[model samples]
Target chain A: MTTKMKIKTGNSGGYDVLVLAKHPMETGNRKDQKTGEMIPAHFIQTMVFSVNGTPVAQAHLNQGISANPLVGINISNAKPGDTVSVSWTDNKGESDSAETTIS
Target chain B: MKRRTFIKGSMASAALAVAAGAGLLKPTRVLAADWPEAALSADQVDAAMQAAFGSGDVTDSGDVQIKAPLQAENGAVVPIQVTTSVKADKIAIISEKNPIPMVTVLDAGDGAGGLYSIRIKMGETSPVHCVVSSGGKLLRATQEIKVTVGGCGG
Candidate 1:
């Protein structure tokens, strides 16, 4: 469980997440077959979701976008266990979080 | 009235200090400039977070659609579904390079056709941008997925 979170309650018409996270989002430009250089794009600029925090959705991403980036959020009142959580912040600041509780 | 009038005012103040140091140079940099000339390569899928989307007026048709997996064995999790009936609420997803590339922003209050799903994380082989804003106006669609595990690490 390095990073991957998905929760759904109420709307799955467009389909809600069941499983996610299989990262490799490297943007430093590959090279380390032993020792090269170039590798410096961590990913994720900002992400916030809440059940006890109360925000729901937010996005501002960049970097031609692609690389271990999953942000699928769509909730009406959130049922199940009601403790779904996620937090992210990047651009070298480095912050990671993940949570799940659904039956 | 002395030394030819101070050498013509010191040669007009040294030619106005060399034209104010050549107008204070440094005005030729536009910032990285190479957004999407082609080779995108970045995805973590399902992104449409919003603080600002489209800035101003945009309209097309077909309501907007991005049902993922045209080719993604595993760019992390490239499963996305975004539908729209042209409602007046909100629906967004952007994965143009998932460095916070504005991914996921869904709010279809009554819960209707502004459907949405998630699972994004691709770092190589990219092109997944589906923008949909209603009433105010802004609609877009793009699909191109192909990630063979670990976004861009593999």
Candidate 2:
């Protein structure tokens, strides 16, 4: 998944950063494109959002969670334009991460 | 290696058998093998929940709160929210009836002020279990939401 993130002041609410990923999070159950066998269930298991080595939000996910879900967080005493980092691990052990400085 | 003729013949037979049985290809959808056991039986549901979070000692300490439909119109996708009275180190949310009992577990980094909100799909009538871990101990609570029936909340 692409690692770049988008940060901006909340249009009408207080949001530090908005994270988007490029992968389809295909619950492995989807039939493979070349191979017809059912793909195993693979999805994001945990996500950690941080700023300057401090944590902001951490969510443990499950299969029932919709693919490509959006997380809106209300930060504590954090203002606009803070450097934020994100880390995620999927069930298949495909771990990848990225960071974005809030605008 | 010289058994090519016999191997090819068996391969062709196997292909024909597969093609003939193509109608039986009702592909398996997730079967959700990991769904928590609470979804199966009422007794197991209660037991699993209790095992995760003790029930009686749980007093209405503003420490924990749950948000969901008092009466969900659709069972397929019910949105629930859980917030704590105090900032927590970890938060967990689970659906009793889901193929798996533990739906979510999150470690509230030092940044977490003990507040968490997430939307989860409920496949049927069930209890939403909310547990918070702190000081090496677990605190838990549960609220039952009645789903009207579409997919999850029902």
Candidate 3:
């Protein structure tokens, strides 16, 4: 449930935020080779990005996103020392948040 | 750099100082109510489109660009980037191979330049579609990515 994130100052005076989440991102279409049963869909449904406690970007994702998904966002008003945070909630009702300082 | 300097200089006013002193720098969160849950969970592409955009009325547009690898070694970690010339208010990504075709929906806030980059899992070789919505019109672009192996189970 611990998501890793990196926030860096972009050359355009914005901040580039990258999130590496740990999840299976199951699509429910794959079958178990041994059992031949369909795997249930399990993936992040919502991801929210916030700066200084204010939401900047929000994404509603589904099973199409790859496993261990890496998402990037650009913040136009971000400063070098500001705090950029991300939180995600999956379809299974699991959620976690991670924060990093913009560098 | 010049724009940054100008912004900084213009923001150094007494009103900003007062706002900073009052701890009001944080803007309120603008959560959109148009999250298409049904579209995301829909098993078929057509059904998903119905839930997302009310209809499958997307047009092929050269203005939308999808940047992804021609061949992905790992289906579980295919990186995809999308950009559009139109002033998009929203962007959606869909993978044809996945059970749920709809992958992600991004709400581009007011005056936001349409650009998104994300990694997505592919069950197999499939065409990934990027849809941009501007002024209630949907424009789309697609790219086929060959996956060596299945990314979900294999």
Question: Share of real contacts kept by model 2?
Answer: 0.32
Q: Which candidate leads the pack in DockQ? A: 2
At residue A67, candidate 1 shows an lDDT of: 57
DockQ (Cα-based) per candidate? 0.09, 0.27, 0.21
Candidate with maximal lDDT: 3
Per-residue C-alpha lDDT of model 1 across residues B1-154, encoded as one tens digit per residue: 7999899999999888887787533232112222221122223232123244435344555768777888888765677877666663655556665554554444444333355656666666767767677777778787877666655453
Give the number of the best model, judged by TM-score.
3
The candidate with the higher TM-score, 1 or 2, is 2
* Candidate 2 runs further than 4 Å off: A1-39, A53-57, A72-74, A77-80, A93-103, B1-60, B150-154
Task: List model 2 lDDT by residue over A48-84, tens digit each.
Answer: 7888758766665655664554443445545556777
Better of 2 and 3 by TM-score: 3
lDDT of each: 0.55, 0.59, 0.79
Interface RMSD of 2: 6.5
CA lDDT for candidate 2: 0.59
lDDT of 3 at B152: 71
Q: Tens digits of per-residue lDDT for model 3 on B71-136?
A: 999888889988777878778889987867788888766433356789987878999999888888
Candidate 3 Cα misplacement greater than 4 A, ranges: A10-13, A29-40, B1-35, B111-113
Candidate 2 residue-wise lDDT, B35-129, digit = tens: 22232222354554454344423333456778778777765456666666566776667787765556665565554534555556566777777
Model 1 regions lying over 4 Å from their true place: A1-26, A29-31, A40-103, B1-51, B54-62, B76-92, B95-129, B134-148
